[model samples]
Target: MSIISSTSHATSNTATLSQRLTAAIGASILGACLVYFAGFSHIEAVHNAAHDTRHSAAFPCH
Candidate 1:
């Protein structure tokens, strides 16, 4: 009985870990797509945004 319960518990933990991993992967892919689309849709806007950020940080973009 003890062995059976331990096995079951381990399987449950593995399933939970797998689900979390899948969710993380999905979120990363979605974020990448969003960034790609945003940059593609407005290349100049993105460039300006980065440029302003650099200037704000005093990076001497020129």
Candidate 2:
């Protein structure tokens, strides 16, 4: 009775804490990846575009 309920209560609390911690870590990792990929992809596109537009005299890519 008392012992069983207390054990269950403790387990529930621990589970709740674990859920919150997992959600926080997942959100943080997702946000970081989104920011990094967005920034890197945009920068890469700009760099490639610039390289493609270089004048023939100054170009070594040909």
Candidate 3:
């Protein structure tokens, strides 16, 4: 395998399911919090999402 392919395969074949899930969930929550607290940083993109357009929950997004 090429270096990139081998590195990708190794990374994809990690040992623990829960560990990976925890990492992914942690990253997502961190990202969401950053976006939530970034103060107008992503307003345009949020405004462009379908949920923000049609089914917005009672958050300050709209």
Candidate 4:
């Protein structure tokens, strides 16, 4: 009985971890898209800010 319960508990934890990981990846992709679009924005301030951010992160934008 204890073994069965422990197995179910582990499965539940794995599912929760997977869900969190998926959400984190989705959020990261969405944030990257926002930054990329902002870098190409017509607004000079937004474009500059994104460019600076990329440089600060050591991500070459050129």
Local accuracy of candidate 3 as per-residue lDDT tens digits, 1-62: 65654444445666599998999999999988865555455566664563464446656644
Give lDDT tens digits, candidate 2, residues 1-62: 35554434444434588899999999999999865565456688765665565544486754
Top TM-score model: 4
lDDT of 3 at 11: 50
- RMSD of each candidate relative to the true structure: 8.0, 13.6, 10.2, 7.1
lDDT of 3: 0.65
lDDT of each residue in 1-62, candidate 1, tens digit only: 35554444444435588899999999999999875665455678876786776789998968
Q: After best superposition, candidate 4 residue 47: deviation in angstroms?
A: 0.4
- Name the TM-score of candidate 1: 0.44
Residue 15 C-alpha lDDT in model 1: 55
Against the hidden reference, what TM-scores do the models get? 0.44, 0.43, 0.40, 0.50
RMSD of 3: 10.2
At residue 1, candidate 4 shows an lDDT of 38
By lDDT, the candidates rank as 4, 1, 2, 3
Off by over 4 Å in 3: 1-13, 40-62
* lDDT of model number 2: 0.67
